[model samples]
Target: MPVTTDLVQQVLRLANEVNAFAKQCGRADLSQTLVEVAARWKETETTIVVAGAQKRGKSRLINALVGRPGLLPVDADVATNCHLTLRRGPVLSATVHRNDGDVEIDPEQIADYASTTGDPAKRRDVLGVDVTMDHPLLDGVRLLDTPGVDSLTLGHRQATVAILQRADALLFALSAQDQPVLRHELEFLAEAMERVQAVAFVLTKVEDSANAQALLEENRRRLATFVADAGRSSPGTAAALAPLLEAPWLPVSAKLAEAAAAQRSLGREDRAAKLQERSGMGPLEDYIRACAGGRELTRSATVVSACVSVLSSLTAVAEDDVASASEDGAEAARRLAEVDKALEELTRTMRDRRRHAVGNQFLGREVSAIVRARLARVRQPYEQAISELGTRAALERYLAQLPESVEQSIRAAWDDIVAEVSRLVGRALNEFLAALGLEPMEMDLAKLSMPTVWSHELQSEPGESAKLDLLREGVPAATMAVTIGMALAHLNPIGFLIGPAIAAAVMSRRREWEQVHRNQAALRRLVSEQFTQAAGEITLALEREVASWRVAVEETADIALAGQRKELEARRAELRAPAGRSAADRGQARRRAADRLARAGELTERALALRGEIGPAVNALA
Candidate 1:
């Protein structure tokens, strides 16, 4: 397997073990961090941004780099408006970012959305374009073709500057026909070098200039001089650009490279190989691959360093706790008793505080008031709609929409409750930590609260069986009574026919009105029940999080005390032994202490070894 693959596998294995350990130790926060770090390592990709001034053939160079001609638009007006991101996929796909949301478009239509030239109204909303191709060159590497740094359009310049901030490496393209190093290019490079991990200068359009070699050499010298001069004013900029300044400049004809790729695709291998050699794109491609490999190594090292630091700190803390507990005789016993008392008192106080916070009538009232206010905003419109419903079909339609409306209202109310509860829990935890004379642990209550899962459960659509039950039980009883009364009051034609018909119609409306009210009342009850359940669940989760935090703190002290007690007990047992007066007994105790110290030394050596491994990985990037 490749080094990248081997390194990733090692990292994932370590992360899994650490995550399990963290959970066992009740360190969910640390476990979550490890999980996220593993995920980031898995998704890591080397991103290169090709940026330069207008008409410098940046897009052409990118297309040639990927060995896919016309993959990116080459026209100046079309290519210089917005940033284009190219990556690998199974098939060609493109999406345009707009103010509303992303819109998928045909790969051929990318130029229209990315350009500002054709139909201003049609492309006005487009923010950027992302394209994915099936080219092997794009695997594990993404290329961003940015707008010209010195474009006449201010937006293009700003967008390029912004994109530079996120680029892992920058390929600065300069036209061979232009001066070796312009002031604008120098300024952009200075800013970009500070933000990106690596930088390289490319002298483009070499076919158009007979003195391309001279331009490349002269530009390299100019860059070195610029860095030397900038060091006097800004040492940081000089240091950041040192790698690029030491690297050689690459000069290539993007047109020739594109022609080579096209010819190869047409089966003209001989002509294509000659054109590719003259284009000098191979050296540039090799340099990019080296930079990408270096970046991956550096990134892996950084993540490993972080993980090692966390684990090492935890181990050191644990060892210190054990050492502190293994003290001698009566003094150790006294310390243990004191710690036990403090832990007991702290536990009691914390429990009381949690109960007070959760069971507080004031908090419940505040939550209820807010929920009611949100519900009231939707209730009026819902009631009006129900009242205006005229026929059985209309009533059925209204009933069908009722659950969704009620769910929306409940969700909104639940969101407010969650925010408020998080604030309360945070405040309570802070107070408890203060009482224990310890700094508060950083906690994200919202994340730990499991809001999404709870919300989904609470907002599930009500069953059709329940809806039918409400209609059947509440509507027909009143309607039947009214029909019987109307039949008995009528005898003549007017009273018998028209009166009964009017009465029956009125009674049906009344029954529907009652059923609608009943349904609303039932919905209100269901919302209240969900709110109470959510509150209880949140309260319990908060208690567990705080309790776990408290346990970790106490466990440290407890471990220390336990070690001391064990040492004291061992001494007592030795003193009571038949050979208590012998020198061999003293020798045994000394050997035990020495063995413990040796174990501690071993742990320290392992930590140092882990730290030592990171340095070479980082240096390999240079």
Candidate 2:
């Protein structure tokens, strides 16, 4: 049976009950872990991103998917430059985020902020668009419409790639007119396969093309070969793409689907049914629903596994405490000493391990080398360009393009740092857990939600501003005009006698050269400063994350010890009770202990049963 939210809720309810029982037993630490696991289940949702090449009918496909004919704006001349995220809400609303700030826009005006040709100001700075509506299809799913991958614009490609990396699943739209996938599409898909959890292809505009099935089959075969080729170069990509190779290739006509949905709304049932059948949209919808359900099931399985691990550890600790408490004083002391010794040794070993992992591998010389190398590479091109420019116009053009180059270099360096930190932290965590005698859990750094280092606020320094002001103030309009006229006059034989004019022009050129050099130096310094600040912030965040993980490991040990000590004290008090106590009093104490053990056993059984019920589905989806 397919895993459902109801099934997950049933498991969550069981966990909550077990948590309450733990609290009643004075095991708050165990209960806290269970609470966190339950929260993970609650926040699980499937995110799907729709992407394709330019003019591939992406917006239309999205509109059809939601059964809304005019929800997203589509045009032949205008291409979407920003991401459009759709989710369920009580009323429809649109929010546009730009470099300056965010603004509330009417839903009908989304194209103004999302498309390339909507508003001139918006087209220059718009970042993304968010739309909310009361649509049933969006209840537990977030759909993102991204700019085309093969867009001529570089920013559009970068935005699409970033979104694809963060998405849970991807719906890669292909137009039937474009028979085989383009090279850029394959490259994007190869990279995306390594990041996203699932992917499926949709061949759009079937109505406009002949032999849609033949096109779909041919594309499928080519994709399979592409996956195989990618696997040869990158085994990880191959593994990630394995399951997707079997995913359904849906051929759909968004135009037909939209018309059919509209007809159904108008109560033309017969016409609607026929159009829907011809559009082949029903199977596509079913495929999306199944994938969404599968993603949820996989997420639930992860939470369940974590919960079970914690509960099992708590159970073992409790059992050990009870057994130790019933023993004589000498035996109890010996066991306590052994535990203390083991913990102390493990603590020392972990401290050294963390120093090596975080201090040396993460934030140490290796990362510093990465930053230095990137900074050098970033400065090389700009330095060369600045030095080679002989005229003011050339310098102005170089400055105009410098900011983008700096931003891209900084973002790339930050990405490398984050990836390295994540790798080191994962290794450290696994080692730390192993030292604590627990099973190692695989960690996905992408899922950790690390912050990005890129911020729009970083710009040219005050010194750089002064250099620019000097350049503008010193270079007079007449001097520039004279310089242009001198070049034109030099082409004539009579211009050779104008030595003084040539001399004045040479002097002006010398001054301009000096000003350009100063400006170049200032710009380089500004970029270096920005890089330093961003690298520092990323390092600090990573250090904090590592520190938190260490604290959690130590806290887990302390909590177990506190619980055990409390249980031991209670047992000792019972033993020290006066002989005058009635026989029924001792009998009651024994009965209470038995009841507690029985309840623990029952809870354990129930947890295992739930795992058994959901395990197969989780494995299949994963």
Candidate 3:
């Protein structure tokens, strides 16, 4: 009974392992195309997924195999934004089944999927799209048109993931182009390796290279290496996937396949069909055969192996920690503890590794670069503001001295100017004094400032050139007539008494007043002339000075930058946190876990030893 139970358990285990590993590998979908497969094994409809990047001719290859020109709408409807499902049976026209209802979206309206607005009756939006046609492969297979994992932004990754989760057989399109396995692709591969069965690789878009056959081998070699590193190597697993990591990479041309399809439909072997004839169909057929159906036998073996690995790790960890004593219950308890520790360690390691690969390497560094560039411009706005302020200051000095220069050149005919201006002032001053209606005594007419003096002071004021006349009219007119008289009295018989008297005084001292006015006028004129010359010269000097100041500021700023360089260095130092966990430490941890498992397996007399070591803990199960 124990032997029979073990046999049944082993068979079930193999199935689970094979299925899980196949799923993980196919889920990556760096290559291959998926179409709606018509075959079904009860609850799960057999959906074949072709996962690969663009330029792999996934569409063309699929079209060639199906023997149809637009079976999956490869030329126009194959957009990289969404997942496509191809189905078969009857000759169904291209219909995009929306959530509301099915719509016949003509090939011309393919853009309607991502379009903002259009005929809702004829277009499917957002929800999902189904394009089906009558084709040979439609009878037993559903092809999934997976957008190139490489070409997707966030929006498309969602769509690709949704299609892959429940895929049946995966035709992995491995382009000679997808070498070194993009970190993202590897990630998806790692996960896929745990979930599906029947994984096949199709190397596409290889028109020419240094040895297509050798390249294929090299590509397969790396695939094997990836499996080895990820702890997925199983002696019992089939060679269908094993050879991939070691074979000469196959060459495929989508264009050639497309030409074949187009020519086969057109009857006679046309010139374009010659190119298709040159393409060897052997490799293509071989890959299809490898991935066409589910591998129940292989999947069964993998499940057993995986379960054993987990169990062995649990048994070893518990037994190893014992005091080298063959205690009955002691060995079991120790193994369980070790298993728990190993699981915890493995989980932590996986989580941390994922964070570094996706969060740090994939996105964190790019984000950091953007932030760093923005900070580099932090000083720009302040520098511009300071430069503008200096320019304004220079402008102010130039305008303050403008008026005086204009008055200086006009200082020639002073005397005649004075006499005429005095008479006008004298008459006005006489009227102002009489308006007070007081008795007028002999005023100091000789000392009274003349219109000539007033005119000079008015012109002397800074920025007052336009208003010079107001001072000239207001002050002189109020004063001169009060000091100089007779001219006013004799001229007007109807003059008021005080006005006449004041006019007489101005006439009497008109000579003395004129002399006094000349001196004041001389001083005012000199002041105006000097300020005028100063204003002009200073404005010109400011232009030159501002230029010099700007240079000095720049130089000083450079010096200041040298001092601040220390702080920048400190900031950069923070970025030097170790990029990845130490591989050596991880290797040692794994070896230690393996040793413990070997001891447990020897005691239990199991054929194989499996170790599942999580971070800081080791485990084995027997």
Q: Please report the TM-score between candidate 2 and the true structure.
A: 0.43
lDDT of 3: 0.42
* Model 2 C-alpha lDDT per residue in residues 213-290, reported as the tens digit of each score: 788877878778878987898663465455556655778899898888889989999999999998988887776676
TM-score of each: 0.43, 0.43, 0.40
- Per lDDT, the best of the predicted structures is 2
Write out the backbone clash pairs for model 2: none
Estimate, for each residue in 177-282, the C-alpha lDDT of model 3 and write its tens digit: 4353443454444444333334555666665544656667776556666566555554323221332243233456665666666666678577556756555445
Which regions of candidate 1 fall more than 4 Å away from where they truly are?
1-42, 77-81, 151-153, 298-622
What Cα-based lDDT does every candidate model obtain?
A: 0.60, 0.64, 0.42
Candidate 3, superposed: residue stretches over 4 Å from native? 1-40, 43-45, 68-82, 97-102, 114-127, 151-162, 177-180, 208-211, 232-250, 262-267, 270-274, 281-622
What is the Å distance of residue 528 in model 1 from its true position?
A: 87
lDDT of residue 431 for candidate 3: 36
In model 2, which regions exceed 4 Å deviation? 1-44, 76-81, 298-622
In terms of lDDT, the poorest run of 10 residues in model 2 is: 460-469
Error of 2 at 422 (Å): 43
Clashing residue pair totals per candidate (backbone < 3 A): 3, 0, 97
